[model samples]
Target chain A: MVRLITHNLLACHAKGCTQNNFPLQFKDVSIELKEQEVNSEFVKNFLPRLEWKALVNTARQLGDTSLPEELPDMVDDDFLKALHHVLFEIHVEEGAMVCPNCGHSYPISNGIPNMLLSEHEIG
Target chain B: MFETPLTNIDYDKVYEPAEDSFLLLDCFEQEYQSIQQRFTGRVPVVTEIGTGSGIVTCFIKQNILPHSIFFATDINPTSCSTAAETIKLNDTHETHPFTFTAMQMNLTSAVRSNKIDLLVFNPPYVPAENVPEIPKDLDDSSWLDLALLGGQDGMMTTWEVLNNLENILTPEIGIAYILFCARNKPDQVAETMKARGWKVDVVIHRKAGWEVLSILLFQK
Candidate 1:
């Protein structure tokens, strides 16, 4: 499935398409939200390792403008809650993650993204 | 003992948890204290490659590491969907324990480098004449062959996962548990991993019918 948490870790691995392949752009996504208690400690620990710009842009693409373009000097509970929602709650039920460099489209059907490359695309 | 999560899994299409899978779970149980100690403070990114029934991933999440995010990948779309169901069934407690995501992809190819803290793989370790072709279509059931057949002493696919470990695992907190059978040569595999400068051990082993199954633990 396409969650920002998982999406953050995925890069285009099709053949030799290497440069600027990260943060696969979301296109035609069906978003689903589930309510869960925000764990501040987890969110805080994970925030430092996240790609801030990619996450913000992806959330915005999913019609969620809760995150800021830049992380604040001191992230408060509101920021942590927003990060938790963006990372854990929102799920892309149906869509395609297109590689920015390679132009390969990984289709998401039934909430699972098919990252299998074609025969010619396998390196 | 953690209950095996195999609810709603069509065993004919997806892999059914067997002795190899149980041996992996046993090792986790045996090393549960150490595992908990290793990841006590942080929210580790735990991933399982080739999640057949998603039983091992579900077990680790529900029982061993409740405070982690999990990513599971399977070449077989059926296994991916089946694993998602297994994860959902185990994560239904009101607390909403862990965030899990499944992808249909090759082993560890879709995951980012140095992001996974704990990795688990139960690769296809049965010696076979040929490594089966990976199914491409969404509804293709031929992937069940890829779930079990391992060419050249069942090491074809296993080697791919092992070689990619250095890139997939977080250097500080990475620990991988991989299953190997006697025919696949467990001792030699451990030696190879040790040669790669990893701290390796046969964490658990059991004689299951004709096959001798062992779970090889690796740390970077």
Candidate 2:
């Protein structure tokens, strides 16, 4: 599924499209809120690996404005819970991840992102 | 032993779990303590490339790292679809903070640099006259050939992942378990990786009929 955690690790790999390809922009996405157990430690452990700005921007685009503009110094229970929800709960069921650099669009159907490029698009 | 996740898997398209897959499972089971030790302080971002049926990743999640964030990728859309279903069906630990996401991509091309904490690959190790090319159609049945027919030496796909290892794996604690058949020249491959400063170990090996399958554990 296209969770924020997975989206955080994705970048466009189209041929010769090297600049500003990260955090593939989501368009026309249908989100599903899956009920998951919130583990504070798990969220905290993954906090460093997160691209805060990209995550915040993506979450906002998906209509979730829970995270702050910048990561807070103090990670309280409320913040961890919010981070957990954003990373694990929100699943992009159907959508398209468009690259900002090359304008290549990867379609998402049934929660799986098709990152396959055409022959002409392969690098 | 962990139960194999085989639900909704289309064997005609996705490569079925055989000796190579089971050998990986056995290696993980034997080295469970060391594997757990590698991720003692943090939650790992575990990814499996060429996840045919998602059994290997599912086995790790169920038996070893239940709290990890899992990702599975395959070139075939049908394999990705079936693997997703397999993950969903075997997700019994609802209380653990774990999630499995499947992606249809070529190797780790789209995955971020140095983000994967643990990686697993059971690549196509059969020596074929011609390695099948990746098809543009996501649902093409020809994608199955890409899953079984490795290049002349059965190392074309495996080398693709190895050459890009530094970009995909985390520097310190990243670990990878990759399967190789005798035709792929496992020892020579191990020597090359060792020369590059990666700690390599042949965790387990078995003579499965015509194929001598072995799993190589690599740490950087």
Candidate 3:
């Protein structure tokens, strides 16, 4: 399941298209919430690894606008819970992750997001 | 390397090829240099679940069988990127249209069902009561828990894999290689595979530190 955790690391892999390729925009996304044992520590530890802006934007795109626009300087329990939900619970069941740079689109179906690109797109 | 392969990997982030990883690679190497015969006639559709650093899959594709498709999946998004990087770095002929891609997926959930010719996995097999629950210590960022925490008896994830073995494997030609430690109970796991009518073998094993890790191969 592609929560923002997975989406946060994705970038358009189209050859020669580099800048602004990151954080592929979600289109027509349908999310399924699968509850996970909230790990406050894991979330706090993982926050530094995330692209904060992309995460917030993705949560909104998926219709979970509970997150603030900015990451709090100190990650509290409430923030950790929210981060855990955003990272592990949300599943992108069906959608198209459209590249912001080259406009390349990777489709997600049955909860598995396909990252394979065509010959021309292979970097 | 998508960026860096074999070396310079941030092991703290993506899984570094460890004892289990080496054992899995040795099995493949031995298979390639077999004294006997071919397991399957055709080129296989290859996949590796939880391909932390993508080294094992890359080794098979590059040195062992250079002309085949490769699919690697990981739950950690960073590992997927790391796997892709490793694939790009290790591929001898990238223009071969190597259908090499790394995906963020749980197990083989996103894979083409039952079409795998050669499937590989070195899962979390460490025994712990609170297996899936991340530790309460905020400073503990190590992903080993995610990669090594196998519930009580260390077979929680293994059972899930076996439960779907029939459906996950190709009807006639699927093969899977999995890693298990002494705590994971290789004998019992073999029995489970046998119960499912799978032909199983302990391909290779070695004593690494206090743990004895073995690789089990299942074929239809």
Candidate 4:
């Protein structure tokens, strides 16, 4: 389940590949919308931990450009719902996550991510 | 310090907080004081391999090291859902917001090597008499086979982690708690620890039914 929230924390870890690793790019991503029971408090609670720029950019990349160009000064129900939808509801079922710098790609299939590196790629 | 299953779906599929799970919980729950004292000058990068239900990771977050960034992996896709639910449910309480993520991955695969501060694995230690095929989640089945089956001698999954520990673990700061019972060869564990230049410290040893389980903590 490669949701925007999970994608927000991922960085490239290919052997000897360091710079420009954070927020690996999604390629040919297929999104699945799952409707979770909305818990507004949980969404509000998680607001601080979010990397707003990374998340908004990711949402745009997934063809969901609903989020505001700038984070709203105060969160409202509509905004929170959008955040919840982007962070939790969207799932990348099939795709590849490519590093911006190294161009190393990790594929996601059957909704399971293969984060394994080759023996030589192990640092 | 365990989050009971959030729902029936989780209870039926995910591995619950059993003795081995609680042992790791107790090891860190009771020992976090000492761990913190020793780590006064250091920070922790905690990860749990085969993080069935994500209770142990949540337990670590709420009870032990709340600030550490936790990563978890499980082969079963549903387990990831259950784990994310568990963290979201349990982490909603009074404690600080925890940073944790569950990925459907094989052991230590997606996680970057040499970055984990504490790698926890209370693996499927029981030896399965009739080894079951890995579940595809497309048919009528229970994937608990992967949860319980540890091959002939019960070292199948643990062996893989032990072999890859060198590449996955942080060089000097990494500490791992690998739990095993009477059947898993202790000698092989000693050899693995020796190869890593880490002395084995038994964090906990107790009888859970017929098996005497030991949660071995080591550093690399």
| The candidate that achieves the highest lDDT relative to the unseen native structure | 2
Model 3 lDDT tens row, A1-123: 456665665566667866888789998888888775665554554466567888898788777887889877877788788877887778787888998888888887655577655455655
Model 1: lDDT of residue A29: 89
Model 2 vs. true fold: TM: 0.97
Model 1 residue B168 CA deviation (Å) reads 1.2
Q: What ranges in model 2 sit over 4 Å off?
A: B136-141
What pairs collide in candidate 4? B45-B117
Candidate 2 local lDDT, B23-74, one digit each (tens) = 8888888989998988987889999999988888888988989889898999
User: What tens-digit string does per-residue lDDT give for candidate 4 at A1-123?
Assistant: 677776776677777887778678999888899776566666675576567898999899888988998888988999988888898788888999998889889888765566756567765
Between candidates 1 and 4, name the one with more favorable lDDT: 1
Error of model 2, residue B45, in angstroms: 1.0
Tens digit per residue, CA lDDT, model 1, B121-217: 9989989988998766655777688988989999999998888889889986899999999999988888888898988988988999989888888
Docking class of 3: incorrect
Model 2 CAPRI rating: high
Pairs of residues clashing in candidate 3: B1-B89, B2-B85
True contacts kept of 3: 0.08
* lDDT of each residue in A41-65, candidate 2, tens digit only: 8899889889999999999999999
